[model samples]
Target: MDVIVNAAASADGKLSSRRREQLAISGADDFARVDRLRAASDAVVVGVGTVLADDPHLTVKDDDLRSQRREDDRPGNPARVVVDSSGRTPTDAAILDDEATTYVCLSEAAPVDRRMALADHAELITAGEGRVDLLRAFATLQEEGLEQLMVEGGGELIFSLFEAGLVDELRLFVGPKIIGGRDAPTLADGEGFVSEFPTLELAAVDRLDDGVVLTWRVDDR
Candidate 1:
């Protein structure tokens, strides 16, 4: 599968505030651009933290943007995926809404009853032990026929995917504002890298009204 991580951060590389909440970092223009990407992808993924914080619908909003996919004989919206290792995702979460097919990737330790609860709204899959093994999750998604996966995330899931060598491309929007806090979230946050960091080759850059969008090809070299 071709994995692309789409995220936006402040000038200081903060994604949210100290409370582990979500903030509107980008404006309408960048959001529309992101919607187009979502509409084009076969699957859109996010971490459970994002669901807890924002409870986003995870559907393409623009009728015009959605119609483009339908014209191509694709689903009006992409399959929505959530990485909830502990089966913590709520059944009533917005992702469970009827707009799209939802998949919840849970850890092997998830309780059977919890799985049964979400089964009505989402197809559940087990990937790892205590936490989701992203590589295994990707393979399961591939086996299920999702070729292009777009990850819109909180930090931990993004870091796990990159650490597992799954990311192929990155789309980053950097806004001008500065949200300064040591506890603030970032683009990637997990076990901090112990060795050299992975490099990304710049593919493109666009200057939007409120921010700049940067595209990078993950340099596996």
Candidate 2:
């Protein structure tokens, strides 16, 4: 599967404040760009942290875009996927709405009751023991015909994807604002790399809104 990781951060590289609340880092043009990216993907994935923090619908926003997907014999919106290991995703989350198919990835350790509850709202995929195995989950997604995946993430998930060597492209939008806080989330924030970092080939750069967009292709080392 083609995996694209996309995010917007402040000039200082913070995704949001230390409070972990949702903040608008990109402008209208960037928003439209993201909507287009979503429309082109087969599934849009995010971690449970992002769903709890942002509650994003993860749908193609443009009416014409939805129409185009339908005309192309695709769903009006791509499937919404949540990498929730312990089934922490709220049943009432926006992604659980009937707008599109929802996939909740869970680990074997997830509570039976929680799994049962989520099964009513989403298709459950078990791929690991303690934590959701992203690689295995994604393989299952690919088997289900989701060939192109877009990941809009919290830092931990982004870090895991890179650590698993699953990311293919990185599109980052650096906005003009500066949100300075040591605890603030950045583009990739898990146990950061200490040795061989993932190499990226600079592909393109373009000015969008008041900031700039940098596209990088992950180099196979």
Candidate 3:
């Protein structure tokens, strides 16, 4: 599967404030770009933390884009995926709506009752023991016909994807604002790498709004 990680961050590299609330860091142009990306993907993925924080719908937004997908014999919105190891995703989360198919990736450690509850609203895929194994989860997604995946992330999930070498491309919009806080979340925020950091090859750059969009191809090591 082709995995793309897309995000918007402030000039200081923070995704949001120290409080972990959702903030608008990108402008209209970037929003439209992201909507297009969602229209093109087979599935949109996010970690549970993102769901708890933002409660995003994870669906195609533009009317024209939805029409295009329908014309292509595809669903108006792509599938939605959540990596919730312990089944912490709220039953009423926006992603669980009927707008699209939803998949919740869980670990074996998740409670059976919780899994059963979620199964009514989503398809459940269990992998790993203590945490959701991203590699295995994505492999299962591919088997289910999700060949192109777009990940709209919380930093921890982004870092996990990079650590597992699952990310193929990164599309980042650097906005013109400074949200400086030591406790604020950045682009990648799991247990950071100590050595052998992942490298990127710059593919393209474009000016957008008051910021710039950077396209990078993750170089295989």
lDDT of 1 by residue, 12-43 (tens): 99998888777888999998999989988999
In angstroms, how far off is 177's CA in candidate 2? 0.7
Cα lDDT of candidate 3 equals: 0.96
Q: Which lDDT value does model 3 have at 7?
A: 97
Q: What are the runs in model 3 whose C-alpha is more than 4 Å off?
A: none
Worst 10 residues of 2 by lDDT: 212-221
Per-model C-alpha RMSD: 1.1, 0.7, 0.7
Angstrom error at residue 20, model 1: 2.6
User: Whole-model Cα lDDT per candidate?
Assistant: 0.91, 0.96, 0.96
Model 3, TM vs. native: 0.99
- Where does candidate 2 stray beyond 4 Å? none
Q: Give the Cα error of residue 212 in candidate 3, in Å.
A: 0.5
Q: Name the lDDT of candidate 1.
A: 0.91
- lDDT for position 180 in model 2: 98
**Where does candidate 3 have its weakest 10-residue lDDT segment?**
212-221
